[model samples]
Target: MADDAVTTGPEHTDEPVRVGLVGAGPWATMTQAPMLTGGPETRLVGVWARRAEAARELAEPYGVPAFTEYGALLDECEAVAFAVPPDVQARMATEAARAGKAVLLDKPIGLTLAEAAGLAEAIDSAGVVSQLMLSNRYRPRIREFLARAARFDTLGAQARQITRAFVAGPFAFGWRLEYGVLHDVAPHSLDLLDAAVGKIDRVHATGDTRRWVALTLEHTNGAVSQLALTGEVPEGGYTELAMFGPAGELRLDFRDLAGDEADSAAGWATVRREFAAAVRSGRPHALDVHRGLHLQRLIDQALAGLR
Candidate 1:
């Protein structure tokens, strides 16, 4: 895909957009389904998964129909929200875009640059409203932090996201264990650093993807960021980002956000509202497929640099 802008389809009047939830995992059940049903801008029209039973189970309480066929779900909804693995998301989301449904995507976009770029091409060709679920970008606290960080001269940044998800819980399963932190965790740090510091120009990395992965990113504006990520931490862990410069140091911690159910709900609510607004207005969102592709490229670069 070229570095050119992708045009959107024509705008429509403000009406509730019918959205289908794809994937029946914890993310879909906990966040996607609730946010889609709980919000006013979008309606939860249906739920679809690779497994019929899982889809039925998730859609039972919500009173929406469960779809065994992906096409049937796509036919019912004006938009689709994905909560599946990156590879699955790439393929299905491309199909949804080609079917003329606005897409609400999850991060990493795809498992590889080729998959990411192909999805971007499909989105561009379809000219539909598309947005990535970079949830933190929707939070008031994170928005405020970005605003404040922009006013400072950031010389460098340090970020770390450690977790025990691979050890237990709903997130313990799937591609997270196979691909490790780079695909699952690095997207958040990479996306935030690109927004806070500058576009990443170069990436250098070292460490093991299964245990620990560390990266040094040189931003286009010359500010560098160091990131350490792992999902195998045994005890307690944290997600933190700090920047230092002549303006002193600025920090944003995800400690409370990680533990606060209300904060997580609020973030997803804002994400859904904005995505529905984009669909109705035919306006491209800041965190769109193109942005996701850019981050995917950065991830590709970092992966290539890894030893």
Candidate 2:
């Protein structure tokens, strides 16, 4: 399926795109649900989750109906924002796209390359617009940094992300504990590196344990990037992504940014705005399903190398 062939949906005559929230998890509560409810270009019309009680609880506060059936929610909404596990997200996102709904998805796309590719193909074949919510990509400062970095002679980059969330926090899911930081957090770092330099052509990765993984990526643009990821760090973890050249280096540290609440909310709001604009314009966003598939392939390669 061709990139430009994807359409958002039928014209809405200036009405805001009705968006449904899927998977009423911590992320949905903290970010996706709030963004859709408050966003100017989108309206939160309904919510669905595997747990009926959870879905009802999430929907009650917003006054939107809790859908017992996933398809029923899809039927009422022009777009779907997913906050589910990767495997569930892969399945439902494919279903949503096949049903002609625009998709706003969480990162990693799916647990495996095959799953990711299938979702991408489904979205493309159905001619539906899609965007993966890589939070850093939606940050204005990060975007500005990438734009400026593009002007410089390319060299190499380094990214380090250390978090304690997997050890104990609202984000500490069993899947994250099983997969570790490589699968849980590296997608954000990889996406940032790809945006700053170019597409990755190859990857070499290794780790002694699930908690720590490192990767060296060879970008198609001749730039290389090294990433170190861990989720067993001490409280108040560190994150830094830096790109270098003869002009010196540019870097961003999440610690230096605003609090998580404000920063995360703002980032998700940008995601909502971009998704809404894509739905309106029928133009694919830069962070589309194909990009998710590419990242998932890179991740799969890294995982293979780890074994």
Candidate 3:
């Protein structure tokens, strides 16, 4: 196979793939930048940001020159990694896909599902390798849970995914609270459960500023899940899921295990690497585009329920 051929490819020539990144945000710095730096198949050559100063700091260590213009960055890279706000993700992704540049977009694809559907359709038409960053699936705890599930499935009647706690990042654009937990963090676990078990038939949710969200999801597999997301808890709490199945039970707490210092984005590094390896082997990504779109729709329904 190609990936087995010397286990190395031309680095950054026409043979090697090039990646240009947009938004020198913390997510990009912590997740994509580090992963790309360590990956052999891709090169990080450019970064675009509104502020050149901030871009230089994050981009330079990765050996990529910073640019102030997003369009110029898109024009050059074979693929683009977007780490901007949810509202801006669609616009950039759609434009880049249309420009024939493959894209790696952050989740909560857009403010709503219709927007997400549009972007999905656009990316499909472009015939490019578009990937969404969904790392919770790669969490060893979660992956083990899935491995053990096998045929019997995880939840018996109903289980719950709980996400609670608060974070205060001064660098954030302050748009964090506007989207609610379902859009912000719930997608990770929700997408996991959806893939591990099945689709969510319905979700009823309610919450406010003090609490990120308090919600429940009912799966078509006859599993019901209660999800609690809030910020009142100290140390910025994290995600935990308990699945009740016929065979037995499975539980994983992403926060308690890692404590406060977990990279939060480390799982994503593996997810991207797996995707790259699959592309080289001509196999489907572990997670597919439809799953991403379906999760977006579930978020859409949950948000509508809130209203």
Candidate 4:
């Protein structure tokens, strides 16, 4: 296809939007990295991993510079995809923001709200584009559910169900469980809930690192949703969201794509693409820095047991 009649979205530019990827993990290697192949708007300019060898392995196939330092990658690229673990998120995000680089951070942006907020503030204060990865929003089914649920009066007296995450087999053997279910899974569900119902008002949660969390949330719109987080049950821990109001019930089965290669990036799904477009227009990203900070604040409260 011609670059002018670009298939991805609007024309990013004739030249690629050079990107530096921080965290050359499996997700980056498979999904996010491959986005470069089909789009004329962007290019994978570099890859950074904690280990230089792993960085080289992931970045080599894409023919980009490989490094063990994120600063090096940032110095040479216009933006970055931050796929690093939570502990290091604030530091890296702050650095990129300080550099005025467009940043795409992975889901559950940070370990705590304070860190996420601080980084978010820096990103915003610097006037840079940034978005957290909540690609589930791009799924067609979820979009449909949001529309149907928007007319709450149309659906009535439906059961609201929330199942805990089930992790077994090799899928169970990872850092996801180590980080616990909420941080790993809530990013997708919480955002969906906020969109479907209104913003969450009060939350009551009960659980621990070893077992499960039963959460009840009151939405600002007088809608309530219960989140049962059972980590790694036999059938596996998947999320099912059902909304019933006056007319019909809207149900969405949200599969956990945390480390899954196929669904990790979820396309030029939502914010990043918006951010990219913003870069072209010389304006702010559609996702904006405030949204990310707000989500981080929510993440923090949950972790802090504020609910």
Q: Where does candidate 2 clash, by residue pair?
A: none
Which residues of candidate 2, in runs, are more than 4 Å off? 1-13, 260-265
lDDT of 2 at 240: 92
Put down candidate 1 lDDT per residue, 60-131, tens digits, no spaces.
999999999999999999999999999999999999999999999999899999999999999999999899
Name the weakest run of 10 consecutive residues (lDDT summed) in model 4.
Answer: 1-10
Clashes of each: 0, 0, 4, 13
**What TM-score against the true fold does each predicted structure earn?**
0.94, 0.92, 0.83, 0.82
TM-score quality measure for candidate 2: 0.92
- Return whichever of 1 and 4 wins on TM-score: 1
Candidate 3: where is the Cα deviation over 4 Å? 1-15, 153-166, 170-173, 209-212, 259-268, 278-288
All models: lDDT? 0.86, 0.83, 0.66, 0.64
lDDT of 4 by residue, 204-272 (tens): 667764366566767766677776665656644456776766555666665533445444344453344
Q: What's model 3's lDDT at 253? A: 64
Writing each residue's lDDT as its tens digit, candidate 2 over 176-202 gives: 777777668989888777777777889
For candidate 4, the C-alpha RMSD (Å) to the true structure equals: 5.7
Q: Tell me how far the alpha carbon of residue 218 in candidate 4 is from the true structure, in angstroms, after superposition.
A: 1.3
Instruction: Provide the RMSD of all predictions against the true structure, rounded to 1 decimal.
Output: 3.4, 3.6, 5.1, 5.7
On a 0 to 100 scale, what is the lDDT of residue 158 in model 1?
95
Error of 4 at 115 (Å): 0.6
Please give the ranking of all candidate structures by lDDT, highest first, separated by commas. Answer: 1, 2, 3, 4
